[model samples]
Target: MESRFLGIAELTDVPDVAVVVDVMRAYTVAAWAFARGAERVVLAESLEDALALKARRPDWLTLKDGPPAPGFDLVNSPALLRGTHLAGRTVVQKTTAGTVGALAVKDASLVLCASFVVAGATAGLLRERACERVTFVVTGGGGRAEEDLACAEYIARRAGGGAVDAGPYLRRADASRSAAELRQGVREGSTPEDVALCLEPDRFPFAMVAGAEDSLMVLRRVAPVDPPPSA
Candidate 1:
């Protein structure tokens, strides 16, 4: 059976599985931090809460920060994550879209953190695992942005799924035509090269497991022990 969509607004609807994205920065930085050897990354919806968590667990090696989308701390930009050495540490990150949406849908049977950084590989992993349904929570900067939607489209397409339509949840959400958004992302220093990089689709097959003593969720490539039948 093929996978299908629920609704964007139904992010917290408790589906079989869901992937929360903050690829521009929150999720992106999480990936970079893990790649830099950080032990794990914790995604928080609030700066104060993340800070408090870090304070409570200083030994966990937590670094509290996230994207700034107005009142937020950091913006979701790949440029920010570059050259950061989080090796053997943990991070407490707060993002406007990715974090909020993720928290909203925290009740899912399986919640996977994703973005362009791990999109393709994530698709394969989900397919292999055979999740009955998968939802993409776009975290639209208090709504939903075109960049996130486009990224979602690519992921949904890659998964060889989309039996359910999510347009209803996106009715009030803002989106740009893929071409225009891509161009703007490039002109704004986001860079077409970065887009290409994120488009690698699951370059990292890492999954974040919550509730572990490891406060930080690092990207660890997952090897499917039971290989699926090749098409």
Candidate 2:
């Protein structure tokens, strides 16, 4: 197996498997939503697209970050999602980084979303598949997002047959500018719990996999046959 890391701009270069990382909040939020029992998540390129999808499917919930939008049902905060009941419901998600990066990968046989919370599981799934070529897409700021880049490297290392300690990578992610933004968001009414939640490596036992369905990118959880030993 061969694995490499790429930025959002290089998503088109993704090969057999594409792993999109957005550790600060986007992919973390998606993992939490799935953990909370969401049936599926639809990746939207923008808030307008999310709202349009919601309008077409009134029962689907729309989630996004930033200022409250007219049709959004929820904010893209894992802390907020923790209290909501999403069991058996479909979610339409739009974010500045994660969702866009996820939807941009056009030719991969498999697409996965990753964060510290699901890093080990994502890598485990890739190993199980015996993928020949894998690319980790750092979705935040076209790879300038340090947290996402660190998470991508961590996953790539693991997928490439390395049993490494996650401590250093987690520390790097915590010290990133995105982490600082998350802290600032907490002071502005977002929950502090999000900071802690986003940094918990391998918190989930399943990987989030995305499959193209018509015009939507649908994400579902897939547990690896053999989970990797704790990092």
The sequence of per-residue lDDT tens digits that candidate 2 reaches over residues 1-231 is 676778877655546788988986888999989988899999987778888898899999998887566888888788888888889999999888888888878557899999999988998998899888888888887777888888888887887765779999989988987777777764332566778889999999999999988867899999998766655
Residue 128, candidate 2: Cα error in Å is 0.4
| Residues forming the 10-long window of minimal summed lDDT in candidate 2 | 184-193
Query: Each model's TM-score?
Result: 0.67, 0.94
Q: Sum up the clashes in candidate 1.
A: 18
User: Which regions of candidate 1 are displaced past 4 Å?
Assistant: 1-12, 59-77, 141-143, 161-231
Give the clashing residue pairs of candidate 2, or none: none
Give the per-residue Cα lDDT of candidate 1 at 178.
31
lDDT of each: 0.54, 0.84
Report lDDT (Cα) of residue 225, candidate 1: 37
